[model samples]
Target: MRIPESFFVIYQPKYTVPCVFDLNERGTFPNHPSVTGTWGFRVLADTDLKASVQFAHLVHRPGKDPQTGKAYEWMVEETSIDLDDQLTLDSAAVEKKITDSEIRSALMDAFNEWHDNFVPMKKKKVDIEELKQKLGNVVDECKERIRKELVRKNQHWVSSNIPRRIHDFKYGLYNHVKERLYQEYQSNGGEDSEPNLLKKIALFNRVLDNFDHEDLMKPDGTVWRNEDEIWQCWIGFAGSEDEAYRICRTMDAVFKDLELDEVG
Candidate 1:
C-alpha cells in the first residue's frame, strides 16, 4: 500500500506576503537561485475588522518569463468564511459595487437619451418665431440697458478703444439694472409688491427698445445706419464702469420721463 504524502501548510498572517519557489530542479527550495522572481496573493480585507477572520483571498499572477519554462502559482484560502458563501462580502464592499454600477448605468442612459431623442428632436423643430423670441429675450435682458444709456447720454458718436467694448458695457448695465431691481424689491415689502411689477415693466420696455435698435442696425433690417464714430464712442464710454453707471442713470431719467408722459 502506498503511504499518503504529508502536505506542509504554510500560514502567512498577511496575504501580501509573496510565495517564492523554483520550478527548475537546479533552484533552491525557499529561495530560487536559478529564477529570480516574485508572486503574491492579494487579500481584500474588511476595513472595519482588525482580526484575520475578515479577509478575502484573491490570486495574482505576474508576467511569465520566456527563458524558464516554469510558471508561478499560489493558492488563496478564504479566511473569513467559506468561498461558496455569498454573504462573505461585507456591506461596504457590496454597497460600493452597487453604487459604481448605478453611476455607470446612469451615465450610459444619459448618453443614449441625448444621442437618440434629443439630437433628433433638435433637427426636426425649426421654429423661427421661437428662435426670435429667445434671441429677443437675450438681447432685451443683455443689450437693452446699454443701448438706452448710450442713446440717453448722446455718447453714440465717440470712438471705441476696443471692438469688444459693447460686451463690457452690457455687463455693466446688467449689474446696474440688477441693483435697481434689488433696491425696488427691498423698498416694496420684499418680493411681493406693486413696485416689483413696475420694475419688471420698466426693465421689459428697456429690453424691447434694445431689440428694436439691434434689428434696425442689421443690414436687412428697417433702421439701418452706417457704422459711425458716435456708435464707437457709445460702446467705449459704456465699457468703462463709471461711464456705464452714468449711462444707466441717464436711462433711469429717461424712464422717469416716460412715467411723466404716461401721466400727462
Candidate 2:
C-alpha cells in the first residue's frame, strides 16, 4: 500500500532563471582540460557552461539509503535549448546569426507589431507653408555663401602661381554651418533621435562640408549587444526546491488515483 505521505508529495515547479550568458563572463567558468588553445577562450559555447551546471547537479544527486527500498527521485527542471549547435561561437558570430537570419528578423517583426500595439508612434501635423518658407531661406543662404566662396577662391587661385586643386575641401563651409545646424538639431527635440526637416538638411550639409570625400565610403554599421539578453538556452532537466515540492504533490495524487483503480 502507498503511504498516506504520498498525498503531500510534490511533482513539478516553475522558476524564472536568467538564460542570458555574456561572453565576457566566460572566465567565470573553470577551464576544462579537454578544450585547448587561446581561440577556445574567445566565445562561450553555452553548451559547455550548461554541461558544467548539469555536472554539478549530477555530483549532488542523492545516494541510495540502506533503510530505504527506493533511491530518492530527482525532479528535473524543464529548459529550452539555444538555436545553434556549434561547438564554439563568438559574440560577433552569434550577433550575425541572430541579426542576419530571416527567421530572427521575423521574430523582430512580430515583436515590432506587438510593441506598436502596446505604444503607437504619435503623428504630428506640420505647417507646410512655414516649413517651405524656412527651407527656401536656408537654400538661398547656402547658395549665396557657396557662390561668394567660389568667387573668392577663383580670384585668389588666379593671382597665385600654384596649380589649382582638383578637390575642394569645404572646411570653411562646414565650420560656418556646424553651430547653426547643431542648434537646429537641438530645437527639433528628441535629442539624438527624431531630427526635423531643417535639422536633417543641416546635418547632411555639415557632414558633406566637413567630411572628406572618402569618409562617406567608410563603414558605419555596428552591432549593439545586451549581456542580459538571452542569446539562447540549453534545454535540460534540473532540480529545484519548488520542483521537489511539486513532485511530492504529484506523487501523492498518482498514488491515490492508482490505488482507487486497484481497489475497484
RMSD of each: 28.2, 32.9
- For residues 97-188, write the lDDT of model 1, one tens digit per residue: 33445533543343334323312223465444553454344334334454455445442322222223444434654444554544544443
Q: What is the lDDT of residue 240 in candidate 1?
A: 38
Give lDDT per model, in order: 0.34, 0.27
Question: What is the C-alpha lDDT profile of model 2 across 6-71, one tens digit per residue?
Answer: 011111112122222212221222222122211110111121211100100111234343454455
Candidate 2 off by > 4 Å? 1-124, 157-264
Error of 2 at 121 (Å): 17
RMSD of 1: 28.2
Q: What is the total number of backbone clashes in candidate 2?
A: 15
Model 2 scores worst on lDDT over the 10 consecutive residues at 229-238
